[model samples]
Target chain A: MKFIIQRDRLVHSVQEVMKAVTSRTTIPILTGIKINTTTEGITLTGSDSDISIQSFIPAEEDGNEIVEVQTSGDIVLNARFFSEIVKKLPMDTVEIEVQTNFQTIIRSGKAEFNLNGLDPEEYPHLPIIEEANLFKLPTDLLKTLIRQTVFAVSTSETRPILTGVNLKVENDELTCIATDSHRLAMRTANIESKINGTYSVVIPGKSLNELSKILDDTNELIEIVITENQVLFKAKNLLFFSRLLEGNYPDTSRLIPTDSKTDVIVKTKELLQAIDRASLLAKENRNNVVKLLTHDGGVIEVSSNTPEVGKVVEEIVAEAIEGEELKISFSAKFVMDALKALEGTDIKISFTGAMRPFVICPLHDDRMLQLILPVRTY
Target chain B: MKFIIQRDRLVHSVQEVMKAVTSRTTIPILTGIKINTTTEGITLTGSDSDISIQSFIPAEEDGNEIVEVQTSGDIVLNARFFSEIVKKLPMDTVEIEVQTNFQTIIRSGKAEFNLNGLDPEEYPHLPIIEEANLFKLPTDLLKTLIRQTVFAVSTSETRPILTGVNLKVENDELTCIATDSHRLAMRTANIESKINGTYSVVIPGKSLNELSKILDDTNELIEIVITENQVLFKAKNLLFFSRLLEGNYPDTSRLIPTDSKTDVIVKTKELLQAIDRASLLAKENRNNVVKLLTHDGGVIEVSSNTPEVGKVVEEIVAEAIEGEELKISFSAKFVMDALKALEGTDIKISFTGAMRPFVICPLHDDRMLQLILPVRTY
Candidate 1:
C-alpha cells in the first residue's frame, strides 16, 4: 500500500482506533493496527477481544484533498510506535509506502522511518451485523445516558453480569440502569422511534466509557445495530463494535422505595461540597461512610467520625423540608458521584427510614433517579 | 492557641513547608507540621531527616492584616490531613483553636474539624548556623543556576555523593557542577561577596529541586549561610535548611577538553527536535542511542536503527560547519536535556574524536557548558 495523507487527518483517526488496541492481548495481531488503502479512502482498524474500532479518512472532503493513493493494499503495523511517529513528525503531510514483504516506509519533511509490518491476512475480520434492527439517536443524548449510569456499574469480577449497564427500549422510551448491589443509577429518555418493538441488552460499562470519549456533543445522529450477541454503533466515518454479555441483568426497579418518611430539597453544589469535605476524614474507614441528619429550621448536617483520625461536621441550609425528621448513613463517594451526574440547581432527596434505601433526583425531574442502601449506624 | 488567618496566606505557607514533608519517615514527629502562634505572627514548620522548611505569616503585610492572633502557643498536626482540610474549607478566613490535652479545633464557615495533635516539644529543633560565611545572590539567578545543572545528578544509589550538586565559591565567583559520570553540566556566575574566603559544599540535588520550585523569579536577594555540616537559605519570611552530603566530590574540570577536532553551530530548537524524533525508534533498545553525522554543505544527519523494530533518519540544516567531518552516537535524552538547559537561540558543539567526550554551549554565552560522552558503535 502506498498513500500520502494529511498528518492531522491521519493523527486523529489513529488516536480513535488506538482506543481499542490492548497491550495485554494474547493474539499478537490484536496489538497491531490494521491499515488498508483503497481508491476512495484509507481505513484504520484496532481491536481487542471485547471491543473493536474502525475509522476511515476519505481521499477528498469539502473540496480539499485528504489522501493521495498511489496503490491499494493492506498491512498491519505496531499501533504503539506508529502513532508516536506520526504525532512527532514535523511536516504537514505524511507518505506511507508498503513493499512486497510488508516493509513499511513512512516519510514526512526531512524525517524518514522504515517500520517492520506484519501480513494483513493474519488479522481477523469484523463481524457483520444486520441493519434491520438498527435505531437512530442523537450522539449527545447517548453520551448523557452513558455518563449518568455507567459509574454505578460493579467493578468487582465476582459477578460478571453486574459489570454491564442494562439498556432497555420500549414504547418509544429508552432507559439505562446500572447498579453495584450497594447503589443504583437509572436514567430514562424519550425516543422518536417508528418501530413497534422492545429491545433489551446488557453492554459492558467499559465499552460505553470508551465510546463516550470518542463521541462529541454534536446533533448528528448515531445508528445503533443490535443482535443476540453483538452490538454496533456507527457515527460519521467511525464504527464501534462491542460484545454483549451472556446473562440476565438483575431487576433493580423493585429496590427503589416508593414512600418516604422525610423529604428535603437542597442546593446540589452546596450539598455535594459539604459531603466532599466530610469525606476527608471518613476516607480512613473502609466504607467511607458519612451521616446526614435533618433538623428543625430546614438545616441538614453532614458529619463523619474516624476514631484514630478526626471528625468533620458540615451544615447546609435546605430550601425546604417536609415530613418527619430522619438520619441516614451512606457512602460519601457514591452520593457525590450521583449528585455530579445530576444536572439541576436543586436536588430532592427522600429518606425511607434509617435502614431502607433512599432516592435522590433533580427537583421536579422524574426522568432520572439514584438509589442508595443506607448503612445502619449503631 | 487561637488564631484567625486568611485562607490564601495559610495555603501558600502550607505548600512551602510541605516541600520538606516526606510521607515515609522513621520519626513520627517528622511526618507532622509544627504550628506556632506568637503575638507578632504565626509560624509553620515541616521537616524530613535531610531538610527542614519554615514559613512565617506576620500579623500585617503591606498594610493588610493577614493573621489575627488571639492567643499564643504551639502544636504539631499531621501534615497530610491539615493541608487537605485547609484546602477544602469554604470561608475566606480560617480559625484554629487548641484545647487542653492536645485537641485541635479548626473552623471555617459552617464546617468544623476536631483533630488530634501532638506535643510541639517532640519536634526537632532547627540547627543554628553562624553568619561567618554569608553571601547574597538574586533568587532568579539561583533558580536558573539550579535548573541548568541539577538534571545531570546521578539517580542511582550506587554513588551517594554523585547524587548531589557540588557548589564552590572562590574569588567572588560561584560555580555549580553536577554529573552522573556519563555527562556533566557546569554553570558559573560572578558574585559580589564581602567574605575573602573560599567555600565548597555538596548539596543534595533533591533538596535543590524542591528549593527551586519554592523560589519565585523575583529579583529579591536570598541570604545563603554556610556551615560545616548545614546550609541555610533565608528569603524574606521563609527559612530553608538542608543537610550537606558528607563526601569528597570528584574533580570534573579535567574532563572538559580545551581543543576540538570538529566544530558545528546550529539552531538549538531544530537539533533538539531532530534528536527527539530519532529517539522514537532508538528507545526500543536499552541505550536510546542516536547517531549524528556532519556532512558537506552544512547538513547534519541524525539517525537510529533497531534490528527488530526499524530505522529513522532526519536531516537538520547547520548554520556553519568547520574542521574535520565527524560521526558520533549518544543518548537522545541526554542531548535533549542539555539543549533544554542552555539559554540561547543558537548552540555550538565541539567534538574531540569519535570515542571521546564532546562539549556543547550557547553560541554567545560562556557561562554554562554541557559535556556528553560518545558511545562506541563498532
Candidate 2:
C-alpha cells in the first residue's frame, strides 16, 4: 500500500478512530488500528470488540486534493505510536508505503518513520452495518440527551444493567433514562422518527460518552440504527458501532412520585451554588448529605453538618412556595448534577414527604426530569 | 475576635497560605491555619513543619478599606475546610467572629458557616528570621534561577543531598547549581549584596518550587535570609519560610568539560522538536535514548529505534558544525527540559567524544550551562 495524504486530515482522522482503541484486549491484534487505502479514499479503523470507530479521508472534497493513492492495500499499525507520529510530523503532506514483511514507512519533509505493521489478513472484520430501520436525530440534540442522563448511571458493577441508559422510543418521542437506585434522570425529546411501534434498548453509558466526544456540536443529522446486539451511528464519513449490554433494565417509572404535598420554584444557579457550599463540610459523609428546610415566606434553607468539621447554612429565596413546609435531606452532588444538566433560569422541585423521592424539572420546559431519594438523617 | 474583610483579598491570602498546608503531617495542629487579628490588620498562616507561609491583610491599603477589625484575637481553623468555604462564599465582604469555646462564625451575604477552631497556642511559631545579614534579589530573577537549576535535582532518595540546589554567594555574584549525577545544570546571576566572603547553602528543590509559586512575576526586590537551619523569603505582605537541607553539597564544577572535540550550533526550537519526534518510538528504553549524528556540511540526523516497535530519523540543518564528526546518545527528556528552561533562540552544544559528557549553553549568553552524560549504545 502506498498513499500520500495531508498531515492535518490524517491527524484528525487518526484521533477520531483512536477513541475506540483499548490498550488491554484479549486479542493482541485489536490494539493496532487497521488502515486501508482504496482509489476513492483511505480509511482508519480502531476497535476493541465492545466499540469500534472508523474514519475515512476522501481523495477529493470540494475539488480539493486530500489524498493521492498510488496503490490500494491494507496494513495494521499500532494506534498508540502511529497517532503520535502523525500528529508530530513536520510537513503538511505525508507519504506512507508498505514494504515486505509488513514494514510501513511514513515520510514527511525531512523526517521518516519505519513502523512495524501487522498483516491485514490477520485482523478481524468490522461489523456489517445494516441500514434498515434507521432513525435520524440532530447531533446537538443527541449530545444533550446523553449529557442529561448519562451522569446518573450506576458506576458500580454489582448491578450491571444499571450501568446503561435505557432508551425507549414510542409514539414519535425518544425517552432516555438512567438511574443508580439512588437518583434517576429522565429526558424526553421529539425525535424525527416515522416508525410506528415502540423500540427499547439499553445503551451503556460509557459508549454514549465516547460517541459524544467524537460528534461535532453541529445541527446536522446523524443516522442511528440498532440491531439485536449492536447499534451503529453513521455521520458524514464516520461510522461508530457499540455493542449492546445484555440484560433487562429495571422498571423505574413507578419509582417517580406523581403527586407532591409541597412544591417550590427556585433559581437554578442560586440553588446549585448554595448546595455546593454546603457540601464543602459534608463531603466526608457517604452521601455528602445536605438538608433543606422550607419556610412560609418563600424562603428555603440549605444546611449540612459534619460533627468534627463544622456546619454550613445557606438561604435562597424561592420564586414561589406552596403546600406544607418540610425538611428533607439528599445528596448535594446528585442535586447539583441535575441542576446543571437541565438548562433554564429557574427549576421546580416537588416533594411528597421527607422519605419519598422528589422530582425536579425546569420550570419553563417539561422535557427533562430528575428524581433523588432523600437520605435518612438524624 | 471579629473582622469584616474584603473577600477577594481574603481569598488571595488564603491561597497563598495554603501552599504550606499539607494534610499528611506528623503534628496534627500543623494542618490548621493560624489566623491572628490586631487593630492594624489580620494575619493568616499555614505550616507543615517543613515550610510555613504567612499573609497579612491590612485594615487600609492606599486609602481603601480592605479590612475593618472590630476586635482583636487569634484562632486556628482547618486549612482545607476554611479555604474551601472562603472561596465559595457569596458576598464581597466576609465577616468572621469567634464565639465561645472556639466556635467561629463566618458570614457572607445570607450564608453562614460555623467551623470548629483549634487553639492558636497549639500552632507552632514561624521561624525567627535574622534580618541583619540579608540578600535582596528581584522576584523574576530568583524565579529564573530556580527554574533553570531546580529541574536537575535528583528525584531519587538514595542520596538526599543531591535532591537540593546548592546556592553560593561570593564577589557580588550568586551561583546556583543542581545535578542528579548523570546530568548537571549551573546558572550564575549578579546580586546586589554588600556582605563579605562566601555564603553557601543547599535549599531543598521542593521548597524552591513552592516558593516560586508564591512569588509574583515582578521586578520588585524580595529580601532573602539564610540561617543555620532555615531560609526566609520576605515579600510585600507575605512571609515564606523553608527548612534548609543539612550536610555539604558535592562540588560538581569539574563535571562540565572545558574543551570539546565536536561543536554544533543550532536553533533551539528546531533541535528540540527533532528530538521530540525521535523519542516517540524510543520511549520504551529506560532513557528514551535519541542519537545524534553530525555530517560534514552542518547537517545532523536525530534518530531512535526500538526493535519491536519501529525507528524514526529526522534531519536538521545546523548553523555551524566544527571539529570531527561524532555520534552521541542522551535522554530526550533531559535535553528537552534544558531547552525549555533556557531563554534563547539559538544554542551551542559541545561534545568531547561519543561517550564523554557534553555541554549545552545559549549561544548569546554564558550565564547558564547544562551538561548531560551520553548513554552507551550497543
Candidate 2 runs further than 4 Å off: none
**Global lDDT scores for all candidate models:** 0.93, 0.93
Model 2 chain B is weakest, by summed lDDT over 10 consecutive residues, at: B190-199
Tell me the tens digit of each residue's lDDT in model 2 across B1-378: 999999999999999999999999888898898999998899999988888899999999999999999999999999999999999999899999999889999999999999999999898888777787788889899999999999999999999999999998888789999999989999999887676668889998998999999899999998888888998999999999989899999878778889999999999999999999999999899999999999877899999999999999999999999999988889999999889888889999999998899999999788899999989983
TM-score of each: 0.98, 0.99
Which digits, one per residue and each the tens of the lDDT, describe model 1 over residues B156-260?
A: 979999999999998888999999999999999877567658988999999999999998898898988889889999998899999999999999989999999
The pairs that clash in candidate 1 are none
TM-score, structure 1 vs. true: 0.98
* Candidate 1 chain A weakest ten by summed lDDT: A190-199
Interface root-mean-square deviation, each candidate = 0.9, 0.7
Which residue runs does candidate 1 get wrong by more than 4 Å?
none
- lDDT by residue (A1-378, candidate 1, tens digit) is 899999999999999999999899999988899999999999999999789999999999999999999999999999998999999998999999997678899999999999989889999999998888677789999999999999999999899999999999887788999999999999998765554589889999999999999988987888888889988999999999999988999878788888888999999999999999999999888789999999999999999999777899989999999998888899999999999999899999998788998899999899999998888784
Evaluated against the true structure, the overall lDDT of model 1 is 0.93
